[model samples]
Target: MKKSIKNLFYFCLPLLIIYVGLEIFLHSLDYEPKTKNEYLEKNKNNLEILILGASQTERAINPEFLDFNSINLAASSQGIYPNFCLFKYFAPKLPKLKIVVLGMPFNAPNTPKEYTSPIVNHLNLAFYNVNTFGRATMPQDYLLFHSNQDYFSSRIQNYFRDGNYSNLNKFGYDTTRFYGAYQAANYNIGKINKSEIHIENEHNSKAIHNNARYLKKIIRSCKERNIKVVLYSSPTHFLYNEMRDTNLVYERDSLVKNLMEEYENLYFFNDEDNSGFEADLFYNANHLNPIGAKKASSNLKTFISKIIDNPKSF
Candidate 1:
């Protein structure tokens, strides 16, 4: 029994040492947390509109177009979960907040279950504390060495390889034209030979329910503070629409319609159905080029003006 105990100690000693070493390294690096502290410090008081969602919303929304101060908290490949986490973090800080525009993409339902990367969670924890980490919609794997190690390694490699993480906010964003409009050209209606929306129908229904829940949370939070919440569907190429037309897209639209009916404060603007534009305006099936973005922005401005002018009509 003494020999067995001795053997166990020997086996566990290296792992314990390694774990301590890693924890010290992670705390020292100060890379995972990114500029969350700076973000909080800068925008705590000045921010008026908060945009949240995946890359599309990040790339699409030009805060300069609006009259109020806005910040794009959108991250690549993220969805409702991160958005919720961010809202919970910033909502208290932004007491003067007027609007929260949430971008709902058709593909949001297809997001994986383990969507929250460890690095992101770690950063969130460091900036927002353990409560925020616990509030993450994903399961906690904070103690998993493999998970944390992988996250740390990837973040370090990315920092050295990219040379600078600040590039993410360089121009910040431009209102002159949509930044990624060219990506939309891949889905021109005239060029399309095949038309089939590939997204799963059942999953789409689930996504819509998830979206409704997400919207409800945002709406409730905003209502408590007298902030307006608007749900806007950004424009996608006709081909992308063809893709979304699959089972999931239909269910998502139906769900949005249901939500619109149920909530007086929730508004849905269907840019996809808006007429008066040619197919060439699209950069691809999922985005609008510069021209399309301008037109879309104009349409949005008009819609917003009307809404602001007469909130009761909406």
Candidate 2:
């Protein structure tokens, strides 16, 4: 029995060494969570604007084009929960944070729970020490090496097999493929896989309530800090807008308008229509290409310039 035990221990030693090495390698990459957290920690005093949201915001807002000192925390599949968590974690540290820009497109009200992408929860906890998982974040979530085998393995493979270290720019904007989600959402959205972005065509009462709870938390946090909260709807192609359920759109618009009335610090800028962002500017039915991001950033600059201080003018 002693000889058998000794043989087993020797067999597992090399496997353990390889596992630890891979863990360190995966954590060392310039993922958005790690780099963005580092950036925010280093520049907490100078951040005037902190933009948070999912894919639509990722495609539209580029901080370099803005006049203020800003950082884009948006990424693909990031919902309101993660946005709120990130804001809550960093709000206290940012002395110069005047505004929080949230990317709230037409379907934003339908942001489902974090279980839709549990890896997001783990990513937040592992990198930024922010908890988007609420009560579901387990101690095991911290052990990314063991808990998320496929996700980490894919990242490892991507890093080694092809040298694809990261898709994020220095500003944390994901310079990756953005059209797949919007393209899949263009036709027969009902049949498209719901894993990527939130473009549900039907009215979901639960999703609306869940998302609203977090949205209100973010607004109230900003209210307490005396920071302005700007929630804007990014431009969507006419085809995408036309395909959406009109009633759902109306309900979402009404929800946002109602919240705006309730919260004095809350402001909304809607660019969901073709307002100069015609077919030529879109990468797909929802996301913008490089040219459109420039145009969108310029348009956003004009709007934000007007509302820098006066609420009445806006």
Candidate 3:
């Protein structure tokens, strides 16, 4: 009996140690909380526009050009769940906020198998600490919280390599340094292939419906507060537009149009248009480089001004 008890203890010890270590490491990389807290401290009740979404918003929108005080709270691959969580956390604190711009792209995957939901983190839970995720309960909240497998590993490496938390700028935008031009293959200096960038049959109704639930929740929340919601698809390379338009695969585009029809306060921008951007402005098929971002921001400023002036015009 004594020997069996000792054997069981020995077997469980290493796993216990690893589990504890992982928990500690994840908490250490809670850089989002720190970045958010700092932004709140500086701009609490001062933000007029709050940008939320994945990486596109982080790289594309510069709050400096906007007519009102603004902050970008977007992160790379952060997705709609995080967007909802972050908005829930900051919306109440922002007394002057008039608009919430969500960077929901055309190709945002919606299938359950595509990615896990309740992608909440310990830091986010500690701050936002909500019991529910839109219409669903987030079971992962009580289980274990890591941003994602890849992000978790990257954060661990970054922690050991001098604690690099440079992703968030003072304005709450990710101003990661990039240089040189985007490399394109089999295209002229000014032309890009549409087939390479178009995402057809990549999403089904289930996936779109799942994401749309949270989007509707956000819209309702904003509506209750009398704030407008702008759902914008950031610029993709011209190839996406040319290919999708020519091939006539409008699954993603159709879903967005339907959503626009459903909600009066929810607006869509540049959903099917890429004429506003040149191929050289993109870093890859989906994201824009700095020059492209500047042009997008300027156009957005004009659109926002018009929206602010004529609420029912769209």
Q: Please name the candidate that would achieve the greatest TM-score relative to the true structure.
A: 2
TM-score of 3: 0.72
RMSD of model 2 against the true structure: 4.1
lDDT of 1: 0.60
Worst window of 10 by summed lDDT in candidate 3: 111-120
Candidate 2: 10-residue stretch with minimal lDDT: 189-198
lDDT tens digits by residue: candidate 3, 11-114: 99998899778866575554544565667668877888888877667677867666678877666656676777788878988999889999866555342322
TM-score for each candidate, following the candidate numbering: 0.67, 0.85, 0.72
For residues 1-314, write the lDDT of model 1, one tens digit per residue. 99999999999999989887866655544332344445545776977777777655655555556555666665555567667778877778886777777777765654542454555555555555533333434444343334466666775676579744443332254233333333333434454544432332236345446656766788887877877777676776554565553665665577677767776666666676555555666544455555665576667666666766788997
Model 2, stretches more than 4 Å misplaced? 1-7, 143-154, 161-167, 175-198
TM-score of 1: 0.67
lDDT of 2 by residue, 142-239 (tens): 76667568878888777788785666666766656446544455644454443444355756788889889888999998899888889988888766
Clash pairs, candidate 1, are: 184-283, 184-284, 185-283, 185-284, 186-284, 187-284, 197-243, 201-248, 237-285
Q: After superposition, how far is residue 239 of candidate 1 from its true place, in Å?
A: 2.0
- Top candidate when judged by lDDT against the true structure: 2
Clashing pairs in 3: 110-207, 111-207, 194-239
